[model samples]
Target: MPKAQETVLEIDLKALKHNFQYLKSKLQPSTKFLAVVKAFGYGSDACKIAKYLETLHVDYFAVAYINEGIALRKAGIKTPILVLHPQAVNFKALIENCLEPSLYNAKILKEFITATSIENQKNYPVHIKFNTGLNRLGFWHNDINFINKTLSLTKTITVKSIFSHLAASEDLNEKPFTTNQIKDFKTIAKNFEKTVGYKPMLHICNTSGILNYPEAHLDMVRSGIGLYGFGNSEIENKNLKPIASLKTIISQIHLIEKGESVGYNRAYKSDGLQKTATLPIGHADGIGRQYGNGKGYVIIKGQKAPIVGNVCMDMIMVNITDIDCKEGDEVILFDANTTAEDLAETANTISYEVITAVSQRIKRTFIE
Candidate 1:
């Protein structure tokens, strides 16, 4: 749309707003939304996304690291930010930028407590993460005593929120497992409240949880992929607008004779004479080699073209024998019609990997 310009990832801000409102509409007025904008907003640009969501009155913003929260604060984002996995080494920056850390373990908790005291931080808010099912991070249920002791030690600082990650809220068939997680979290919260005076702004649902388990939408929800579109497929709603579209152009075309080989290792040997189009995108540009040798495809003139041969680091060749596409024609890697999820299925991965793995070297064009 902006004329031929190398490979570009187009970001749609209006679609972002639509997705936010769409997800928010499912919640009650008392429920708050935490827009997870870490990893450059899932590789689409965090500062831009955060600024847009700020206008939409999002309750909070979340990042995986202290630097990301610091960047948002530097960009004039006043909304509360939760640093989900902040390290103790960066406690100074977190305090300086007013970024709340998710104290997942006792060691980090003590370090933060000491840092807060040294900074004379009175009532500085922080989040506590519990490992309900996602054992990758957060404190376990058995660690409740340790957490209680930490809180008692850090009376000067405030525990703003307590949260956990859901293992699978999208799978309706796994509803029993999800329910058990919810039940476990509820039990932990009750015990925590008994020790801490009140529940620390409990939250457990991610994007899918927010939609599928409204009963678990305690005080807040941290939505990542849903904000950028694509909910857990087990759910019914597919209304969220996709905020990003990856596009490229046919740089060259070739006519292959019968039995001719394309790309390295003769990976795509032609059955007969065929036409192929080369695109200026490859594994180096975030289109991994996993999509090579007819595994991946691109849409040219609305027709699907299967990628051929080993994908090069900077380019890929797609079969276009049956299509009438020409050199320089625009090609869509994935869009509203084709769907990134479909592409991910072909590549044996998820939409999250496809979107976030898009290399930073590729140019990005933002559209309002």
Candidate 2:
């Protein structure tokens, strides 16, 4: 089906492929690669991105919740998918779909064991998340005995891998902390292997960790934002290609005289005769009010137009007085040249928040 000419997000699969290949080059032949497709592929359709990564031969795929894993499974994604934070309530659905859960704590571990036992399943694959200073979700580092006792009681499940989240692997200044986390993971992992009498796959490197700490890559490495063309550093970002381009068009052009207001609550008043271009995107579309009063802009006719007023729910007006533009003229919200990082910096946020906040109502166009 053809796309509407209004507002659209263009996803370049070629750029995605380039990023995957580039990140994969950083790994050893022995290390496995797991791609994250959670948050609907970081707000780009998960199923399509997973299908692409499958062809790239990514060994594993991870999602934050059970429903996301089920969605991918329903989409016919055959790769082994790990559900990062599966709730106990969704254990049945997860097992029914053959999705492996990352059992982080005692409650989840016990519940999953019981669930699998009820299903008459044996040696069902599961991942273990260790709390390596992220403190988000994971078994505590001191819980090795507890975990051993718990798993020994039930032969219904098996540990496929052990992993943790690196809180500051991207920050060069925090290398000391990152090093400690790796050391901690190694100590616990070594003991855990000894206790279990078998070695489970070990991983702790995130995208930043992947770029900075190759020694800690362990048996597998997970790439999330890097595969989406961000390396969390200026130097690393130079080597990656952005895959998503957000483009919109001017819905209307207003000629306002001096002292006239624009958008909601009279947030912006024209200082002189001005041309304002109203775009069909606003706070709801991920461009927030903090980007208002000239903090943010859009590229129109190869020129920058500053955002003028309070960003409305579905509209944002930009000053286009000096640039000749009209209704239906293409406006570049963000692209390779005008990057997500640039917009994120303008909003005092990060690229992940900006891209993920793009409402699902907007149509997405995937291109090679």
Candidate 3:
């Protein structure tokens, strides 16, 4: 909670716990919780967040790739890890690390089976992803028979779960679409259970899906942004708390004479006499160019200072004319109060883009 002396991402474990519990409260007692700690725990800190969540007994963890799962394993995470997208080349390492892979298509499924067999493994857990409507990944509903027939040929790999992704569960106007997606998944699960001769675990809900579709809670629910304190809606946002706060200190202050331009390309020219404060963070640090040219602002001494000119590689100048602040004073880019969502709105983006865009170069401080 101390003032930041440099650009840093402050992660509050307490807020994480609150968000986890808040989302967990919405699920059935028997429903499993899979915390998606991918993207460096939404650009906070994955290993630290996963370690903390492990203490709370989170049922499972998911990552976007194999190395992310490996990182969790390296961190001594004992809970099951599901790699959302696994490459064939890393199947050996995945098995070595005991990370389960989500086999979405026939090619990946076949390659993984071959890898498992070659490794002399038996019943290695794997998740089956079906493309209900997302059309991004996973097999089709008709591909169930292919998946079942393929699995029957090999005893080295076992399906641990059958799941799908909802296209837009957070948007109420897409209720019909989401409903149909859920219904399709249920059909796939049923057919899969019958053909495979047994039922693996079933899940299809993401963070927003968890809040909007309780009926589709199924056997497990995966949460990514929700655990980082975003609910995808104004009303639901009130119930969750964002855990990461991006803070920095003013490196210097400049008095701009009227009509003087600032930063590269002279993107910003002061119309009148103004005071600008330079902070040690910019596009390289994850405040993208879209947020430049007056689109984004930082909080200084309880006031908003609009960003001036184009964002630099490692710095940004904010108009601090009226703010009573000096060099070394603390500034907030985004936090619990002035959230990433609020800032992203200025650039026509979302909280996920802003938070996950935070560069790894920035120092991360944890508040336990």
Candidate 4:
């Protein structure tokens, strides 16, 4: 890739392919792969990422909302898409697009069934979500009987898969909790199959679960962060490549004398002669205000230039006094080398927040 003349998020298809293959290698031949392309493909371009993944023969695609699934359908994605948290209002639209919904609660299940019946649809696929431990969504274990009875009353909708979300599959200390969640999911599946008289696919593993719990990789595994070049641990990160690189160029250079202040509210005061370079990226571009005041730094000519002062809406100034750089020089906010994980650590957050927070306004260029 050439030097970036303006703020841009470069999505690397090669890296995505490598990550997908790497994750797939960990699964059994019988296991299926569901690529989670929600949150704009983790803040990259979802349509582009999904298109590339489709060529890789990803078994399925998962999105958080009906609109997201609709977007993929509009983008010509034909693979099965599971809407993880679809709303009742969009059940009609969801069915029209052939998007599966994860019915987590009685209310939603009832509404979706009504919608499907009204649409004169039969055996329309839908996923049943069980609340193993996430508490975010999904039905309780006791609801299995209710779900089965409800399903018995209608043939318009069929259970395509039964799934759950792991709360802390990434932390070893949470091993007990994660294993329990998996165990609970297995119990739920057994009861569900016995009640429903047939088995739908069972999947509960996310990216971290895929790495940390091989025993739980039941029928399929869902990967979001791992597909985006993060494995949620130092060891796994070495095997994966970050797919997005945020780059910008120096718009201006300034020389500040002692006692000179920079940015809003005079957040940064130079104690000595300092040189700073302004880059056309800031909070509006996902480099949040928390990264200011020497918390975060950008790479310039192989050197680290600390971000000084507060981050403005559309620009940030990095101290470049120790670096040999000039206006129009390429600046790396985060890349494979200076990763988003590394940058996120400076602000006490995770890589997901950093990457997904990247503003959609930023130009997204892909490396095919």
Candidate 5:
């Protein structure tokens, strides 16, 4: 590992494996597990994460875009890949790379059929997405006829799986809505299966869906945040190990008198004698300016140093008055103990944004 880099993301593969085992234990032996490795494996490394999951016998991999699947293929990933949001322009590349596209809309469904027919491919894998409740992607339950018509009209494409997304599986307050989504999905799956004359793999649960509604596991379960060591509830969080930790070094320190200001726009002014430390990380590295002022904090040698002043594009200032810290000391932006969830809560955001926001420029060191 290159310790020379000022800011680095440490990925513990062991912790990731532990999380995988814990999640797998929640599923039936027949149910498949698809690991979501989008956003550069949640800003760690897609190839590395996928490689690890492949060994654990993860049934499938889901990426947000086609390019991610292609990158994994180039890296020699043999497991089938599901592209959640596919575009017409990449339909050609999708087939050429053997990446399965999740056909949601009629246009994509028709276009993919045309593309595969031109290639004269038979039984090409494609996942049918149903819009259960998210209102984001997938076909409506009413569109089963359109889908059946399209499939019956051609042998160029095959139904690899039928899937849907749950919006509030983690929120108990929305259990009724979640239950309705499951009901709609099951009806759609059964209708589609009978209409198409083939039973495609069915899946609808995400991480929260896996934990909160296990019976709805269907044919498979997908996990993104959970695999990266985050749980929807406190009890689950304790059982999962955080896989990523953001660390940096205190580059410099300053001693200021009363009324002295620091950082751009004079966003912070010292009320009395104060000490501040600067770390080589900022909004550009995913630590946004909103986390500045007295909101976010960095752990320095077990002591909390609240951020002061505006977070710059490449640097941030933190008040370290009471801590016996110095230049070049180790600083933890967030770790297994303080987690991305805890840090994001302080900034009024979610863990997904916190980890994905970490700049790709930061070197990632994986612990085997």
Candidate 6:
């Protein structure tokens, strides 16, 4: 909430709560919800988001790294945290913080077992990641025997959950592949339960997975983008409300004659008697250069203003020939009306990059 900050990210906690409710209503009575707070809660604010989710009684919290879980623990988040990708080097810290790690390989499993034994821990919770199809990070189907053998040797460690990632859950065209992944995952879970004598909390559905494949929501659903408001599915996005809006101020205005150019490299030439407004946000604030040269736009007082030239490190120009706007006019990068998908299409990227790449330098204002 400091002054003079040109760009700002406004977060709607109320909208977040609404989205949570929507997802909750869609869940079966027995299913649990695990809020994904990794990547700074997709660049909003992890601590704030986690605090809010805790109030709503979110079943669990998820993070991509051990440090992120440690931060949540320090913030007084008592809910169980599942570390989706924790390394062996941070096992001590993870244990000290009561954070769970996803043991995807025998090496990591052995290392965690040793670390816990050194601490004299009992039944320390951890997750097992299976590489059903994503092949990104997890033990393969053949590694199941190796996992069972290792677990049999250790009594201090307990399997908390076994999960996998869905690569193409949003595309209906890939229903066969998605279904196959679910099938493989279920097979692994059955075999794993037989070996371990019980099934750990099984989870596989991401945001899109939850919408497109509800049956895959076995124990818990890890929701990331959907919680921040974009479900990436046509049907789900319709019900989801955006939680973040980028806003900036018009710092100056210029009236150029015909053939006069603007911005670096003179990328854009004024058509004729054109007026341009310069905004106080640019690439440094996650407004990339790809949005320059008439590729992007901003909303000035609810009126569309087309971007003019190359987006600079700290500023971007918008053509406002017909709009009446002062130097201090408010401009919106994207909001409920202007979807992030539109901005992503304009920038030649995706909505995930647009929302997650927002720089931390910009002030974040939360509204309930």
Per-prediction TM-score = 0.96, 0.97, 0.99, 0.99, 0.98, 0.95
What digit string (tens of lDDT, one per residue) describes model 6 on residues 263-346? 999999987999999888889988898899888899887788999889999999999998987888778898777978789988
Model 2: how far residue 308 lies from native, Å? 1.4
Clashes of each: 0, 0, 0, 0, 0, 0
Can you write out model 4's per-residue Cα lDDT over 1-368, one digit (the tens) per residue?
69998999999999999999999999999999999999999999999999999999999999999999999999999999999999999998999999999999999999999999999999999999999888999999999889988999998999999999999999999999999999999999999999889999999999999999999999999999999999999999999999999999999999999999999999999999999999999899899999999999999999999999999999999999999888999999899999999999999999999999999999999998
- The residue ranges of model 4 lying beyond 4 angstroms of the native Cα positions read none
Q: In model 3, how large is the Cα lDDT of residue 88?
A: 94
Worst 10 residues of 2 by lDDT: 1-10
Off by over 4 Å in 1: 1-4, 234-237
- The digit string of per-residue lDDT tens for model 2 on 241-331 reads 8888888999999999999999889999988999999899988987878999999999998899999989999989999999987788889
Question: After aligning candidate 6 to the native by TM-score, how far in Å is the CA of 355 from where it should be?
Answer: 0.8
Judged by whole-model lDDT over C-alpha atoms, candidate 2 comes out at: 0.91
Candidate 3: where are CA atoms >4 Å away? none
Please, what is the whole-model Cα lDDT of each candidate in the order they appear? 0.89, 0.91, 0.95, 0.96, 0.93, 0.89
Answer with 2 or 5, whichever has the higher lDDT. 5
**Which whole-number lDDT from 0 to 100 does residue 237 have in model 2?**
90
Report the Cα lDDT for residue 266, model 4. 99
Candidate 4 has what TM-score? 0.99
Q: What 10-residue stretch in candidate 6 is worst by lDDT? A: 1-10
lDDT of 1 by residue, 3-104 (tens): 445799999998898899889999999999999999989989889899999989999999999999999999999999999989888999999998988998
Q: Is candidate 5 or candidate 6 better by TM-score?
A: 5
Q: State the lDDT of candidate 5 residue by residue for 121-194, as single tens digits.
A: 99999999999889998898889888888888898989989999999998999999999999999999999988
CA lDDT, candidate 6, residue 344: 91
lDDT of 4 at 123: 97
Q: Candidate 5, TM-score vs. the true structure?
A: 0.98
